[model samples]
Target: MTVALMWEARAVAGRGEELLAWVRAQDLAVRPLRRETFRAPQDRVLVITWWDAPYDADLPELPDPDGELVTRTVHRWRFEPVAEG
Candidate 1:
């Protein structure tokens, strides 16, 4: 099966670039099949990693950034694909 892990965070005011750079620097202990990063208004950063594993399988995920860099704790979710084109 294929699973996707989503990690999202909102940086402190005017720190969007730093936050995006930090996310890009992170290295997962075990590499995923694919990974992508995104950013949006409000200094939000999102990272999605695709893996070939069971839904409940243990997997590596991005760790939380330093407290001074973000407004709140990070948010994460795991998903299994439901459909495709």
Candidate 2:
């Protein structure tokens, strides 16, 4: 099965660039099948990593950034593909 882990965070005012850079620099203990990052107008950063594993399997995920860098705790989710084009 394939699992997708999503990690999202909102940076403090005017620190979007630093937050994006920090996300890009993070390293996982094991590389995923694929990974991607995105940013939005609200200074929110999103990272999605695809892995080959069971839905309940333990996996590596991005850790929380320094408290001073963000506005609130990070949000995360896990998903499995149910359809495709």
Tens-place lDDT digits, model 2, residues 1-85: 9999999999999999999999999999999999999999889999999999999999999999999999999999999999866
lDDT of 1 by residue, 1-85 (tens): 9999999999999999999999999999999999999999999999999999999999999999999999999999999989767
Backbone clash pairs for candidate 1 read none
Q: What is the TM-score of each candidate against the true structure?
A: 0.96, 0.96
How far off is model 1, as Cα RMSD?
1.3
Candidate 2 — which residues are off by over 4 angstroms?
A: none
lDDT top scorer: 1
Residue 32: error of model 1 in Å? 0.4
lDDT of 2 at 76: 98
Any idea what lDDT model 2 has? 0.98
Per-model CA lDDT versus the true structure: 0.99, 0.98
